[model samples]
Target: MDITQTTSVATQAAASSADKSAAAISSDFETFLKMMTAQIENQDPLDPIDSADYAVQLATFSSVEQQVKTNDLLTALGTQMGGVGLTQAAQWVGMEARVAAPVKFSGDPITLSPNPVAAADEVNLIVKNSQGVEVQRQPISVSNETIEWSGVDRSGTPFVEDTYSFYIESKENGQVLATSTVEAYGQVTEARSQNGGTILVLAGGSEVDMASISAVRRVD
Candidate 1:
């Protein structure tokens, strides 16, 4: 099913659950009230029940009723929020999201955003294949905001089409300082709600949390 339909069904389920809980709470409350009334009416006239005892009973029931109502309202609010999130996430489909993860390469150059350490004097791009095997390493400009990777190997040959990861290896005085993955843009093919959060599926069928997306843009 599509995202919108899936979310609607989920919301309906939550609403039904809330309705059932409210009904059960109401039934229990009515029974409590009826039993209390009967107790009061059948109390011995000479030794009538203490007014303080009745007050305590009423106060306790009132608290329980209030708590149940509060829970019902909260459940409804959560359902509403989930629907809103799914609606927003559905709009992200067909767009390109910038994230730090492996991306599938199919002959087209991929744009990468490298973040190198500030203290490093040199930075190199490290390319790894799906199996985490290093395939290419080349020096890159430190000040470049974005780089279009040609998906080529060190021997100047095009790599076989597959999922690949890119990293920025920062060095100072020939000593490695830090290595961090670079963000790349990938088309978002699907979106869904999982564990109360939105997840986006990229073109390669990889799933990423919506919160991890650094930027989005329409596919050129």
Candidate 2:
């Protein structure tokens, strides 16, 4: 018979139960009774099977029934936990986050994009360390959308790998012009099982899942 057509866990348990009942009472319980009677009639009557063996069969049936119910309960719990994880991912849609990152900033090839499109003259970028010390000053010549720097100092020396902010200025009179705007880039802080798998949103603008991440960083 087809064994997997049952609906509810109770129904599946019942079907398995019926199959076991059929095996326990193969052709008929009456046939077993009749055969036992005939065997008793033909035997010497002192070597008959003990009555306790039948009680053992009843105990086995009870154990199997309880096992099927327990399995069903566990399956339900797994489905519930998966739903809870998805809900947590939804809560991280707009939160700001910084992800794990291996920074690869070469002081010799540092370049930043142009903020104001119209002003395409020479702009100066001043690099300052965390202690507010002026470390490097270079003239960034802008012609198009981005300003490319050779990551060199005023004396044409390469910069060391560290966190620093730049102050862009007008190269004519050496006055500060435009400040920098840092953007957040990080991995998905959350995930969920949507139609099938999951969807994720980073701290910035990109919408990716748990799998699309290569690295994370918070560059200001």
Candidate 3:
């Protein structure tokens, strides 16, 4: 099902659970009250039950009842927040999101965001296929920028269609400085709630958490 429908189902399930809990709490409260009343009515006239003990019992029941109500309110709030999250995630569909993860490359070129170390004088972009084998290496600008990969190997031949990952290595005067980070771009094809969080399904068949997206832009 779609994200909206999935969220609705989850909300309904939470509401049903809350309703049952509330009902059970109410029933138990009523039974306690009935028992307390019976005890008071059947108590000895000369040796009546201590009023202080009854007060304590009543106070405890009141606390439990209040807790149950609080739980119900919190559950409702959670459902509402889930709905809002689903709404926001839905907007990501059909958009391109920049995330720090590997992505699939079918014939289309993939965009990579390279973050180079500040002290480095040179930066290199390393492309690796799904098997973790280096396929291409190219010197890139030292500045943090987005670079496009045409899925070609070192010999200028296009790599076969598969998932690939990118890494950035920064160097200073031929000595390695630091291995920087790289971000991948993908088109969001679907959004859904999973395990109390929203997941963005990319067109490349990869799933990413909504919170993991660093940047988003509409697909032209």
Candidate 4:
């Protein structure tokens, strides 16, 4: 296994074990104190408990208690570090991430990253409105290069300001081969952690997991 994976597993196991161990140690310490007190109180004055033996028992319990405290501190520190990790993820804000999410049109050209199929001889850009209606269809180059899409209709009239989805329709000899949702670069508005994974909120209020990000770049 990878070292990072092994370390993560070990850390999680240690954290879980620490909590259980702390509880058990606390119970044991209480029992030990009660037993010691009962013995001291019931002992005869002539044959009293030796001070040296009592010291040894006290020192042992003290060491065990200290160990439990140390474990508790480690657990707390782990939690703090997890929070710090999310703080670091905040740096992703303001950057552009390539994701397959709707692009919010607000009187600005949206850049789309369309990936046409290799077997496609022709490709067409299919624009869908917020209500899932096909608003426009136009031919586009069958290449992986980014395309700037103006949020307008065939007559060069701007559509209503709303979220729009783009799909790439691939065809071979006028027969539709496949249509797939295209990815677009959207600026990150926020970064947060959820369910042990990082999530990036796009400018259009769309949330995507870190794993869904295809590429990231500066908003130049």
Best by lDDT: 1
Candidate 4 structure quality by residue, lDDT tens digits, 1-220? 5324434664576577778887888899899999999999999999998999899999999997998789777775765555555565576788888899876778888889999989899999999987899989999999999999988887889989888889999999988999999998778888765765567888768888877888888876
Q: What is the C-alpha RMSD of each candidate to the true structure, in Å?
A: 2.3, 17.3, 2.4, 9.6
In candidate 1, which residue pairs clash? none
Clashing residue pairs, backbone N/CA/C < 3 A, model 3: none
Model 1 stretches astray by more than 4 angstroms: 34-49
The CA lDDT at 137 in model 2 is 68
Q: After superposition, how far is residue 99 of candidate 1 from its true place, in Å?
A: 0.8
Question: Could you tell me the lDDT of residue 106 within candidate 1?
Answer: 86
After best superposition, candidate 4 residue 22: deviation in angstroms?
2.8
Kindly list the per-residue Cα lDDT of model 1 for residues 54-93, writing each as its tens digit: 8999899889888988887787788778778778878989
Tens-digit per-residue lDDT, 144-171, candidate 3: 7787888877677888988777899999
Which of candidates 2 and 4 is the stronger one according to lDDT? Answer: 4
Model 2 misplaced stretches (Cα beyond 4 Å): 1-48, 97-190, 194-220
Q: Clash totals for all models, in order? A: 0, 3, 0, 0
Model 4, position 52, has a per-residue lDDT of 96
TM-score of each: 0.87, 0.32, 0.86, 0.65
Which candidate, 3 or 4, has the higher TM-score? 3
lDDT of 2 by residue, 1-220 (tens): 2112212333455456656655555444556557667765776667765667556654665576566556655655544444454554555544433322211233534344434324435665666654557776666555334455455666767777554545555533444445543222343444445443345654223455544443333334
